[model samples]
Target: MTPAVTPAARPRQVRRTLPTEEARDLLELVRELIHKEIVPVADEEEAAARFPREVFRRLSGTGLLSLPYPQEYGGGGQPYQVYLQMLEELAAARLTVGLGVSVHTLACHALAGYGTAGQRAAHLPAMLGGGTLGAYCLSEPASGSDAAALRTRAVRDGDDWVLTGTKAWITHGGIADFYTVFARTGAPGPRGITAFLVPGDAPGLTAAAPERKMGLGGSPTAQVHLDGVRVPDARRIGAEGEGFAIALAALDSGRLGIAACAVGLAQAALDTALWFTAQRHQFGRPVLDFQGLRFMLADMATQIEAGRALYLAAARLRDTGEPFSRQAAMAKLFCTDTAMRVTTDAVQLMGGYGCTSDFPAERYMREAKVLQIVEGTNQIQRMVIARDLAGPPGR
Candidate 1:
């Protein structure tokens, strides 16, 4: 036999360490699941705008859906930092799935943070587990980013409240098992708003035709019509006049989820670009070999890495229970902008192929634009940051 040939040394495992091992393991599990289940069917589902209800059930079965809430409520009780990482990984593969998680988490927040003990005990288990999915109903035809202007009305009759209004751009509009609805219970201002948990099957509740969106088409977004929908007083979250505060706080946390998604999308674009550049030829050489092209790739990679760092820093602050609203806003603003830049560059790097549906760069570009708009517009994020720097609201 020929002299024993040593097998080529296996590539060294990077062994990147997160702040917590548990979080790292969770992220790895999410990545594995997305690659195996979500990625394979993403394109087809997106084309049809079909909500991946089964995939969500599978995610729930994995206990991924219940993270970031107390274990008593059937949640995984993981910290926000870990939860955000999972969101990042999911969004990187398919934004619809990522938004589903964010919407569910927001629903859970109303119950976990503000609900009465009876409400928590009654609804938390199903909501946190794979058995039920939840939606946030705050935006209306008159209010999108200006959520405080929602026109939904809730009038008390004896022990029951009759709700009437249309909530717009509701994720999981047609499929959610329950809705965390914010309706006017007092006068016509933020002080009048009150939060409620309305079952999906409640009489007089219906979802309009889903909105045709530029991206994230796999998630159903539509107007939720509540016509004479009745809810029990027991379902109210916190006291009256607390709705606006609760909504704002939930958004502070939600922004971080969007930022994480942006980071993942940018990373996907960078990875795809790198792979394409390595194989595509130009002028008798690989496109990646040219100095100009190489610099563009370098800049793209740097932006993605920087975006990741910013989101993680904000996440850490959140996990530690620090005042992280400004940090969260900053991360959302920066990461989304970076995603737009990197994905656009990715398309340019791939030349003709990137602009076509044969590749995902164009899709990635469309998705990146929505990130800048949702959770809160990038302009709103800047205002939040500036306000924080200027001190309190009155200051």
Candidate 2:
């Protein structure tokens, strides 16, 4: 067996205990790609609030976009554990890229997992292959975490379906090539919802201006309006009235993605804090030599490690086809909160420098805040875990 790279040998490397040689090789490739393509331009592109469409296309060309899905339909055929660890590395480099990949995976779930065989053959290739992007539409203006309360409606019009309503907080809202939309099709509540694959250029489908976010300005988040958008019956995923279940299922994996991204952000903050303290001298000694500051770095490192372990555990369960919802919720809640604390402390460690955009600590703190809110809020994650623990809301 070949020896793995050690901290002394690869100082800036993210040490991973991967399950396969292929996975390790893949990680190395990802890091090289980040250094060559992403890192040099991430700060500039983000500052300009420019989306990295070509970067995503390059990633798709590299097969990074389809890592966890089966390969027969143009995916990478890696396990979720491996795929999410890749996400962690990406997030450490840039949040917009990491979360964009996550949302794209979530968008493909409906068709990849439940679409008719014909549907998969027709669309999965382009979506998972390259040059095409997708968005998942579940939340609405009035329904963020109360996804079941969404007002989007899909009415039957003979052999076609007409979708109407707005989907809020949609990542890649305007730039996506397709949208996996869930809308009311039956009566009311979760059971009434049906999912559809709507083309981004469909008549009456439009995007509002992107939101001015606290961070991740490079990511285009906006409300996607489905104003009488029409699609063929063949576009509907799974059986009618199954959209809520599908959305929740997609969110389980999505939560783990957020958790992985959180760990990566926390890890990045810790790395910056370590480097900052080591180089700066106070009282004629490196600040890292001070016990108080040393303890802070220790705590930050411990929290990041714990978060990585928790999210990886959840991802492994997903790989094994086990009941992982509760674990996913726990990972999402704990990891995001850890990110918030660690990033804040990272800024404190760097003192005034950290608070400025010149350092990444302040930016990491802002980015961490959003992870706690998306993929179901931390509050909602608690609810999901509690419901899993004590049974459903009613029984």
Candidate 3:
């Protein structure tokens, strides 16, 4: 008979290589915040299907709301690589919080990258300071992956643009302080789209009741209606017909953010599985002592590490001023798939206990499903990569 072999008493720590002392400190601060604040309340809040608005306010106060933007405009001025690591820590504790930060960053991208000096001076401060949360509005009732097919119209009315249409599947739809909206202003295709910045309190804008989802119910997802909402010309992020470009640019980075979140969720599930495998005993020995179960855990760890590497590499490319869209698509596609697999296996490893809310494995699995669908579905990601490989139209 074999003696029982136990898992190590403590949770295994992940090894990370930080670029600077400041980055190292930033990650430590984030972990402490997660441990003290988020981890304790995550399960309760998730179970009750309640949104944690105050938690975001607290994150803003802690300088975590805008870590990767310019410091002069009230951001933390951290590098993408470092910022992502902090996001990973946040996700491990509570995925809703981590993903919320990513969507906020996406909402700010157009104005930060293309707005005029006056626009930046007037608005970037509040946004990067974390005092305000923003939402991205691109998908319409008729358009999901087919962004160019959107019909939201914005007509120029002298000093203001009047918008009339509905945006669907918007994260932070009702709760955001502002919205980065894309609307059709000219012809029918991508060339006609324009991006605008609209206040949450705009006269003609309203959000529908939140969507009932499989998981991440703590975060709101809703449809926003624009009944002739009006905005001044100065609110436009770029030129009259540049919304498509802006949206794509933002997505390149947003995909990386999603990839990072996937890895973090997977990491959390893996950690839980590891802890359980070590603690639970079976047939005169620890279940983890069995080669089959041990190998399953090993594969989960390997998949997570590979996904992490892919996203980090894409981030590094963005940092170096390289064209990383293809790599970003690849990372998004691969990482999200890995997340689903890892989370499923994690639930499997723990047997019956994994399926209950008593363990996070089931929730992680549900959360992982949506990552593949957001920021353009993994199928769309494949289309993007294949287009790059095969060249444009007839090339």
Candidate 4:
């Protein structure tokens, strides 16, 4: 994962209010890791397009990888609010690490949430704390946002199920130790899907070359081909045809992770802008002295603070076991949009320097854009929010 290459002076984040001392300590540990390990090598590794497998292993060992899971399952047992704050800090340092952690957590969701007791006992510990990596396989080349329309087929073959399909846009595709795969097992819609925990090394499982993307270069996004890969019945998560519900539930939480990452990225951009404006000379003084630029900076900071509060409120709702899907969607939508806007303004504030690779402003701007499209696209989030507000579309 690449580190934040904003400036010599690292950006200072606002102090957060935590519910417990342990949560507060966890955040401090994460910050230390970012400073000591991530921030230094981010630019070099990003330019090389290298994936930091070791960094994830370290995160796993530190309990950051499974913070929101239950303690009985070898997880950190922290609340979602605390877990998300950690994500934001990691993302501020580097998106590859932040998004990778989110994707891994999403990959573990199926088994942790819906797997039988026996399955959890068998898999949860290794997944949560054994330094193993995972990939979530739900989207396909043919299906992106329309998840229910996925065409991957899983056929029951005696005690094993043979899965055959290509999963697209999978983070950690080839590198993951396992995959949480959703495939069609019965009819042809959401009701037909089933979730399976497939070992990544299973026969006939392969990953195509990673896609060249506009940003987040250190994170690999690839198409995983499951060519008649076989998984035991023991690995199936939940009952048959219940995968869609599980996937939707996982996404509700996953959206919150994306929101936190967005806020972090925006904060990084804002910090870069702040640093640049203060140092860059204008007609007679620092550019930050100008009213127009100061106003822009003020607006950027306000949007970021608002986005953070929105996501945190949604997280609190989830922690209280209240309905939070609509709020999650709203947070994802607003936070990612805020990231895109703040990063763009950061680039604008830096003038010519921001446009160059010598500075991180342009890179931050590029990275901000993908947040708007990931988890659920901002457009999709709007649809979800609209559905919650007005009952579904023709109602």
| Residue lDDT tens for model 4, 204-312 | 9999999999999899999999999999999999999999999999999999999999999899899988888888886878888999999999999999999999999
Best by lDDT: 4
What's the true lDDT of residue 15 in model 4? 80
lDDT of each: 0.84, 0.90, 0.89, 0.92
* Ranking 1 against 2 by lDDT, winner: 2
- Residue pairs in steric clash, candidate 3? none
The residue-by-residue lDDT of candidate 3 on 230-273, one tens digit each, is: 99999998998999999999999999999989999999989988
Query: Per-candidate TM vs. native?
Result: 0.93, 0.96, 0.96, 0.98
What lDDT would candidate 2 get against the real structure? 0.90
How many Å off is the CA of 355 in candidate 1? 1.0
The sequence of per-residue lDDT tens digits that candidate 1 reaches over residues 1-395 is 11122211111221333667777788778878876898887766776778888888988888899888898878988988778878877877778888789888987887899888888999898898846888988888889878888899999999999999999988899789999999998887789899999999999999999888898888888899999999999988999879988988888888888898898788778777777777777788788899998999899878877887888888789888899999999999999999999989999998887887766778889989989998789998998999999965777
Q: How well does model 4 score by local distance difference test?
A: 0.92
Better of 3 and 4 by lDDT: 4
Q: How many backbone clashes does candidate 1 have?
A: 0
